[model samples]
Target: MDARPLLPSNEPDVASSPLAVRGLTVSYGEKPALFSVDATFPPAAMSAIVGPNGAGKSTLLKAALGIVPRLSGTVTVFGEPLARARSRIAYVPQRASVDWDFPARVMDVVLMGLYGELGFLGRVKAQHRARATDALDRVGMADFADRQIGQLSGGQQQRVFLARALVQDAALTLLDEPFAGVDAATERAIVAVLKTLKADEKAVVAVHHDLSTVPDTFDHVLLVNVRRMAEGPVATAFTAEALQATYGGRLAVAQLDRVAPR
Candidate 1:
């Protein structure tokens, strides 16, 4: 697969980045998941966080969003603390992490995205419903809006979740393994939606596992292994040396060729 065109040579200013983390560290009890990790995801770009299993890719996203407790470090959204910028961010946890059995319809899940604006006691207005429907349409899940979320196929459910995130119209959208367990058609649909988001100048960051798609799917990448290993345009940071350092000996020669071909 060919790499996408690179973003402008001039990197975004640190403070202007959609998401920025400095000295971030996270631990569960005594086991450290990430240490002094720092990363900045630029606006209007698609970035992938890739590493081996247990390499802290998910931990980095969780810690940066304060979903998991952090041992140290600060996370900034548009140069401000998370609290001041919370409304501008939207997150989609891994599909495996969600309890799909919950008795909610697809539309109900999408509307939840507006909870911040519509107070708990507030009513859902016509405009709100319209936005929710539009989001579902964008992900090609509009027909399933009334269907029980648990009844949909894995790819369909993922599309519904993406629709939910779209309703928020967030400036920075964070997703955990969006392409996991999906069919080829679903993956193509999701990639198209992500590119539309980028075209609209929204920042898209996802924890991705399919190394083969990185070059064709993302504009920038962050290679991690409990710490920041390499990060920049895919052409520069996604090198054989960096991949070797990040994955160690876990990647087979053939797999390595697919990711960073000779």
Candidate 2:
């Protein structure tokens, strides 16, 4: 897969970014997870959110999408508030956070992505099924459409969730650790689909854990450790200094050499 940056023809102003977070903060009880973090993910770009464990990387996404309660901050999608732009965004949560025993077939799970468009009393038509099937095929899960989600391997489950996000055809796609437990082939499939998304002028933002894959996978990176450490193009912002500041001593020296060798 070609991971080269595919810049958008007409870049929108900062205010019109696909996703823009301002003064975002989240807390669990008295513990602050994210603190006044501000970041912007541009259209047609693949961005990664990276940090050490418990560094509020996931919290930032949850807070931005209103999945978790925010103590203070505002989230805007395509220059509009979340409510107005909710349909334009698609989210794939952490695979570990999902319950595989939900008793839903792979097709049923993928169809759930259309519920926003289906609405109350809206029926699932043939075209909707076709769309779901196309999304499944893209992620190499079309054959497992009838299989129970719980019966899938860890990598297959991740691909299914990604297919779920694909059906939405959202402009801004947010994923939490899409490659966490997936096999190499599954990771390649996911990366290919993400690159396709970028080629189509869509924005992809994910909470990524593998620093080594950062340069090869994402063109933009936001380094977070309870706050916004650094953010911008991978060439400049994904430097050794920013990574060190983001991971501190928690990241092994050898790991740094692979990602941001000086």
Off by over 4 Å in 1: 1-12
Deviation of model 2 at 134, angstroms: 0.7
lDDT of 1 by residue, 101-184 (tens): 999999999999999999898899999999999999999998988999999999999999899899999999999999999999
The C-alpha RMSD in Å for every predicted model, in order, reads: 4.2, 5.2
Q: What is the TM-score of each predicted model, taking all chains together?
A: 0.94, 0.93
- True-vs-predicted CA distance for residue 193, candidate 2, Å: 0.3
For each candidate, the alpha-carbon lDDT, in order, equals 0.89, 0.88
Output the worst ten-in-a-row residue range by lDDT, candidate 1: 1-10
lDDT for 238 (candidate 1): 81
At residue 213, give the lDDT of candidate 1: 94
